[model samples]
Target: NLGSPDERPALYRERSPVEHAANLDCPLLVVHGVNDRRVPVGQARLYRDRLRGLGYEAGEDGDFEYVELGAEGHASSDIDQKIRLFRVLGDFLDRRLG
Candidate 1:
């Protein structure tokens, strides 16, 4: 509505490559905060969906991982996760990539 399709062709052209590069078949870890206000969690979710659509694994058993830290706000700025979460993530990655 803001801009016609033709008016945004350049925008699409510039972003397509980044999206395509992200969709490659490889291991991906996406860690985020549920309360992040800067970048909506849905954006990460959409990216995960796109990567999954591109034939990447995206599940507990897949190459893609999504972790949502609760009440952590946008970043780990000062609110770090409890030790258990770190242990869980470390163990997960160790088992997966190790």
Candidate 2:
């Protein structure tokens, strides 16, 4: 664990991906589970918003992609969910590195 944000504000600020969105130099893929309790879905949304604020669009044709799985939390257990995640990852890699 990274520790509490309130207890270690500077560490959190320094380690936050959103805080360093300007340093991104390649395609990014952010996948998050809607039911994630360890790291809430809002964090992913915030990161996407931050990237957008910095003029980076999100999608297959954009600089990044954000995928939210409805019935997942922290990790995937269902077969369909796993397949979907792999497909998304594969597509992103193919588009970026093919």
Highest TM-score: which candidate? 2
Clashes of 1: 0
Candidate 1 has its poorest 10 consecutive residues by lDDT at: 16-25
Query: Tens digit of lDDT per residue, candidate 2, span 1-76?
Result: 8789898999999999999999989999999999999999999999999999999988999989999999799998
Candidate 2 wrongly placed segments (more than 4 Å): none
lDDT of each: 0.69, 0.94
User: Which pairs of residues collide in model 1?
Assistant: none
Candidate 1 off by > 4 Å: 1-18, 21-23, 77-85
Residue-by-residue lDDT tens digits, candidate 1, 48-98: 777767667766787778777777667565524756467658877886878
Residue 17 alpha-carbon offset, candidate 2, angstroms: 0.5
Candidate whose lDDT is highest:
2
